[model samples]
Target chain A: MWHVDEGTMNAYLDGELGDRGAGSGERGAAERGAGSGERGAETVWEVETHLASCAECRALLERVKRVRDRAGEILASSSPDDVVAPPFEEIQARAEARSTGSRVLQLSRIKRLAWAATVVLAVAVGWYARGTVFPTRTEQVSAPLAASELEESAQSQEPGAGSGEQIAASGEPGADSREQGAGSGERGAEQAEEGAATVVAAELDRAVAPADRDVAGRGAAAQTQTPAEAPSTEVGAAAPPQAKAEPDAEVKLRQEVVDVSAQRRRSDAGDRLAAAAAPQAVVQQVAADEPGVPVGGIAVGEALMFEDSLWIAASEDEAQDALGGDVPVIPDLPVIDYWTAPLHGGEMVRVRQRLDEENVLELIVSRVVSDVRAAVALRGIAAEPAENEAQIAAKGSLEAVAIRRGDLRVVLRGPVSTDSLRVLGEKVR
Target chain B: MPTDWAVVYRETYSDLVRFLHRKVWDIDRAQDLAQEVFVRALDVDAENPRAWLFTVANNLARDEARAAVRRKKHLVLLKGEAEARAAGHADPHAESVEERERTDAVKRALETLSDTDRTVLLLWDAGLNYGEIAEQSGLKKGAIGTTLSRARRRLVEAYERLEGGHVARG
Candidate 1:
């Protein structure tokens, strides 16, 4: 049988002696021999024989027993008070506080967003109501005549025949004279008047002349022509009363022309007003369509007026179509009130000039708040300057301006004071 | 059914700390590590609470020792200074009650030889016999005799040196 070694002894004491303890066959046989508790057990016999014969080995066993006993005693005597524990309650409390704080912060953020949405919704509804309520105030006035009416009036006043002479000589002019002559000659005055009125109404009902047609074509061409030898000969010369009434006729005609001109001017002005108001309405409409954009306190500034180059290039209908179906053919939006907070830097004030989907320009005003002290310290300066130095530096410095637009809101920062903000409110178009 | 941790803590915390103190040289650190082991045990599946507590305490001591070795490598100067301060603080009380405790710990360490040897000694101290230790420690029954003999020889050698009036190196 193989003798036990120190490595094997260590492994066995450590309880790592399974499967690979030295000399498996001999060890198994020795275990069986010892297990029987026989007086002459093989393994016990060998160990006892060695202990009796070898003094060194026996001494080692005795020492091992003493050592084991001492170790047990030390382990038993050791006390529990030596170790410390972490304060778990404090950690748990801190964790709970952080969780509750974050939840509160999240709730507040949601509340703010909800308020902004409500404001935007109210503004959009108000704008739409205003547009629908006032219609006549937004369209232009035009004279109600057509081209066929003028032609019918001209045809009824035929001249040159003896009958036409009688018609012309009658006290009334043109169509009125024709009606008077027809009654005195053959027809009843009532019939003639009815016929004359019908013809005149029909003539007035004609289609409007093209705008390109000259004014001269509107007058009686036959009256302007003269027979040979009479350059300025007067017709119906004996009727001095008629001749005296000519100035009145001229005055009446001039009055009609002036009235038409004034009406046209009013119409043009109304159209321009409507055109000017359109983009503001469109911007409001777009803001309403998007659910997230803030509407309340969003003061719309005067729309920068530029003639739409594409609209000027194309016909009105094409321009209307290109702008999208939602934009009406005639847009009549009023100027919306808007404001932008200015960003103030040392001696420079910045304001937001314009805002669109993708671009923004800020107006920088220099030295606007020249007397006010800065409320906060400048970034990147480690030690705060002394009180005196701060006072000297505070001489109303304008800070850098930033113009920012996000998914929901737009902001402009500069040196604009509260008074300046109020003034800006008045100036918005 | 699992054992209740609150009961386990009430019953075994003192014993567990004492057991860990025997394993680790530093009693304060041992107590701290033992408390951590109990806290962990509170979360463990408790089929056998006592065994689990013992196992976890042993593992934590082993981990602490490995960490100490790593820490010693990085901050050698700091460690040496700390040890010196600790020794200086203990010097006045060395001949008093603390000295007896220290001697007892040294004697126990001498009793435990290799890691395997110490484990077996500890299992035995826990009142497990050779057969039970074979099952707990995965040792074969046949090899226990010879292995114990060699382990005993080493333990005796270690004890004799301590008994021979040799001072322990700090």
Candidate 2:
């Protein structure tokens, strides 16, 4: 007896009076489209039965149908003339490329701080490797450079105005000298690939041709870390008169500026992973900036912003002036170049003295300061003093000896025995 | 298993473009918006992808419209230049021009309807049946019929009003 509503009339007209499927609703009027289910059939019967008798309902349905048809016809006129969606393969390519691009952008932004960070890493790792990597090299190269070689080695020490001082003079471009210490732990890197251009080979031969007999007289500090390293060092030791490293032995213990740079370039991955070994902050930064780049990629960038806290100077005197206190040295080892990043209120200063063209000695003279917050701590650096030996944990591969002389802590890093390194530490005291 | 988007793309592409073309009022922009929808679709995990696509497409269209309104003056100038360029083109078929005029008339009619009414009408036109329309428009399933009936009546009346005005002006 009740009149059918306008909605029912339109529903019947549009042929969409349908029930849902499954737990209902996500399916678009699913099932059989129009009036399909038992519930839908009942609605259809009720609407139709009402329409059969009600002339008013039929007229109303007729009016709605005309309006609907007119709209459908009008909308049909605006159908966009043929559109082809881009191939799915193209979208997939875009996603991959975009993912790589975003990582690059992140690294680019990081470089603003990262370039400076590399220098901090270079110095800090040099300091840390003195403790950890040295003990390992001392075990490997220690016996060769015996106690007798210490005096001979001391006389052999010629910290000349080498490339480091020359660079220091020219506004102290920190990279070349600083990076010399960067991959010192990888002294055992595999020899440069053979068949390098003859011109490059000739230059490296001349450059790598440093006094190896003199270095061996200094001791076999360059060999025996790895089997791969042994062959190159043997080549250097065997070819004494020719210095060391021929077109084959390219292991210049005094890293050929070009060879060292090349070595730095080659060992970049290993160095960054090794470098990423500490200070918590650098690891977090690297992880945040480049999720794709292994979390350890730039941990080797060891320096912290000594801004108001640390500053690397151009000259030793300038560093001394900045320290406002005496910067200790290994006496006769002419302080070729020293850069300082003032820490714990100028309580510490790092002196990088060239032991030979092949070695760098990092003498960190710090007056007893409470704060040990220098980013110099690598993973597993033993802080405890064992008997009378410097707390030497064989870290990477750099040979170092740390001796705390009363209030002063002197760390000596080079390719020498713990005893030989102690002699160097002895000179500093 | 991941949704086979390629299958959905091929099936719904034409309808999506047609739907976007009405909202944006430009064939090129409509196709671009449709591609954008699919591009974003690739990243999401939609249980009901078809419904998800249209919903995202609708929101994107609204955002595009808001941006278009801010750039309306610039668009008016661009439209003038486009009209001039079209006028200069040599068209031999009069039927093509008549088809364009009819589309313009329909576009004008669509712009006059209230947003909800226009959305209800367009959702149905874009091939969403009653239940989908009700879900998309947040209307009761039964009320979708009533909403569509009202929307269609207004749309036709608006078109006739425009047609009569054009006849008078001519």
Candidate 3:
């Protein structure tokens, strides 16, 4: 008697090995496993005789049956009718579309490669032509130039005819040519500074408009002072002749512009930082009937110390005045006593104080931050799952919780119980 | 004698789509591939039309499976999923969240199996006989049962692991 392999036994269990034309003995074994009666009774008797003795194969068969049954349940749930294929017309249209799409994609790829190659060739040709067409200009000679030559050179470099006359009239023919070059460069630098100062002042004025008119006024004064200091500095530097006046003026103007632009940039940057750091206020105004706790604004970065008894409180009006906006209020909860105040940062923090019968106080301070992800890595709290959101798990004695609510993240820190923390977190609208 | 093409189309179209749906995970794509099989079948004269149909459908599915692998950066597939949802193409039979999740878990589990195992399991689920599946899969007719057994065990294990991940994420 040939022994049945595990695969044959498994197939027999699935009722899949019934008619595969195996050896008569193997077929009898499969027929017995499939529970086929009457016609295969002799075969069943023979298979059962083997099964009764082979404990290992019988146990393996039971395990295969369990897996097959479970998988069968999963497969049966996915009905063909559950997915209604589009009408035949749509299927035909899609097949045709796919055929056409592949052709179009191939053509488009070829077109793109050709266009790219052409663009590269055009860019290469343009760069080479630019190098040949525009050769570098020669330096000016120290020997005094005739008025016409100076005018031509000055007109080419600078459109201003006045600059040509200054160089021609200097009368000193052997003045270092390098000095003249330096003077021209200094003047160009000065003009650039003046332009930059004007733009910065205009931008600052626009940036600070209406909200801080005083800041805009200072920015405008700085703009004007930058160009104003340039001329006097130039006069002192080139005292030889007024012909050198332009260079001295240019040098001074350039220096003043740099100073003013740097100051304006720093001021602009500070204002931007302040605006960005302005805490996001999450407000739940106190219920009119209950009036549980009054909310007040506290200065930014300053923590209000509570001695477990004095409990300094502020009304909504006081909080608004302090925070420059409406204050976020903490909801009343049974297990915890709430003392609320606005922090100077854009966020409002609610401190929950739990007082035991012995008068030992536990403090939990929570606030909204712009991002919860940035604060998730605090020293103690690990993230855990809560309903609809995730909460930070408390480590040992220190309990900290942070949950994201829309664009803002509400964080809680203290020894508050998990239930109390979740209750408060949900209250942050 | 040539086969009756209309009779063959009428008999085989729905099963072919159902078979492809289990492979592709998208009903629209399955229907398109099924129709494409018929379009190719218009040119063939086979004595065993049913086996021939399965063979050609398998080839088309294999080609698409390879193409999908090559196009693994799924920005297009993500956009397609979003568009499909908007168009109400999601599983209509899912009655509850649990059922939908189970179906999704099963689909993901099927993805983890070897291509042959997945094909055999899906073909069996689509009501293919062992002999027909063997013909389509190029496995011996007697070996189909063994393959099905291995495929079922692996699928259940993969599915359980995926369900565990969902719990962890939650």
The C-alpha TM-scores of every prediction are 0.32, 0.44, 0.36
Least accurate 10 contiguous residues by lDDT in model 1 chain B: B70-79
lDDT of 3: 0.47
lDDT of 2 by residue, A1-429 (tens): 345555556677777654333233222222212442212222565667767987876786787778878889888877766577778777667666656755654564376355446546554554443323222322223223333332232222323312221111111111222323433344234112111221232222222224312332122232222234334444333323333323233234333433333433443332332333334444344334322322111122121221123435557676666446667787766677777543322335678786655556676555444112233332222222233121122233344455666555555655444445665665664
lDDT of candidate 3 over A1-429, digit per residue (tens): 344455566556655543323443223334333432212212334445667877765776688778888787766555445444445555456556656755654564465455446435544443333222111110122233454553354344424323222332222323332432433343333444433443333333333333332323222222222234424433233222443545544344335444544543433221232222221111121112113211221111111111111233555454344334443333432234334432212223343433333222233233233122112211011212232121111112333344444433344444334444554455654
| Model 3 misplacement above 4 A | A1-3, A18-49, A52-56, A78-80, A83-429, B5-7, B66-97
Once fitted onto the true fold, the runs of candidate 2 whose alpha carbons sit more than 4 angstroms away are A19-42, A85-88, A91-429, B71-96
iRMS per model, in Å, is 15.3, 17.0, 12.2
Looking at candidate 2, what is the lDDT of residue A228?
Answer: 44
**Which residue ranges in model 1 land beyond 4 Å of their true spot?**
A1-429, B6-11, B73-75, B78-101, B104-112, B127-132, B141-153, B167-170
lDDT of each: 0.37, 0.52, 0.47
How accurate locally is residue A332 in candidate 2, as Cα lDDT from 0 to 100? 63
**Distance from true location, Cα of A357 in model 1, Å:** 59
Q: Classify candidate 3 by CAPRI docking class.
A: incorrect
